[model samples]
Target: MQDAVYGVVSNYYQNKVKGNHEVGLIAVVHTFGSDLKWNPHIHALFTEGEIDKNNKWFKKISHIPYKYLRKSWQKLLLDIIKKNFTDIRTKRLINKLYKTHNEGFYVNAERDIINIKQASKYIGRYLARPAIAEYRITN
Candidate 1:
């Protein structure tokens, strides 16, 4: 899952930045959501734009390609699944998913993080949060 998030975001930035230059990011895997169910997902904080090989930022992106990202992320994840498992049923299911989700999987991001402080806080909030708050867990 971590690899999936990193791969999808890296691909997006690499295409945008147009170089082998690195894309900085930190991805945290959460096996549960706010409700504490076994809902697996990733929370990632990364640079909006990347530096080029010549040590120059190509541009400051105010927005990301959401549509492109959704499709790419879906494809990559399905590919990963396919690679990991060689079962016929799994392949059939993956094929069906490709045809079914024409618009691709859902991918969301904040419109803008504004600054490192905000981004740090946002990621930290999720990382440090408890599955069940202490007050709620009290008997």
Candidate 2:
């Protein structure tokens, strides 16, 4: 699952975010949400832009259409799952999900980070946090 997510995201950035270029990024997989549910997701921190084949870094365009990202992500994720699991029931379920959700899966690219220090702090707190913090658990 982790590999699939990373591969899809990298491909999305390379092909969609910046054509003919690759983007550097770090993806942290979070298997559980704050409520301690078995909800898997990824937190990826991408470079402000992309690096072309010429080894030149280019800042990404200001606008990245959320709709495109969502649709692309949904397609890629479903493809990955279908390729890995070939069972009849699984394939049916995936197809049903695809037909059910026209907008695709949820892929949100949060606000940009202007400060490196602040970004680092935020990443550390989010990616390194425990699955279920004792403080967050009520008695």
Highest-TM-score candidate: 1
Q: Pick the candidate with the highest lDDT.
A: 1
lDDT of each: 0.80, 0.76
TM-score of each model, in listed order: 0.86, 0.81
For candidate 2, the 10 contiguous residues with the lowest summed lDDT are 1-10
**Candidate 1 collision pairs:** none
Cα lDDT tens digits for candidate 2, 35-68: 7889888887767577888998887654456787
Per candidate, the number of residue pairs that clash is 0, 0
Off by over 4 Å in 1: 52-60
Q: Relative to the unseen true structure, what is the C-alpha lDDT of residue 139 in candidate 2, on a scale of 0 to 100?
A: 89
> What's the lDDT for residue 134 in model 2?
78
Each candidate's root-mean-square deviation in Å? 2.0, 2.7
**Model 2: CA > 4 A from native:** 1-20, 134-139
After TM-score superposition, what is the CA distance of residue 3 in candidate 1 from its true location, in Å?
A: 1.6
Clashes in predicted model 1: 0
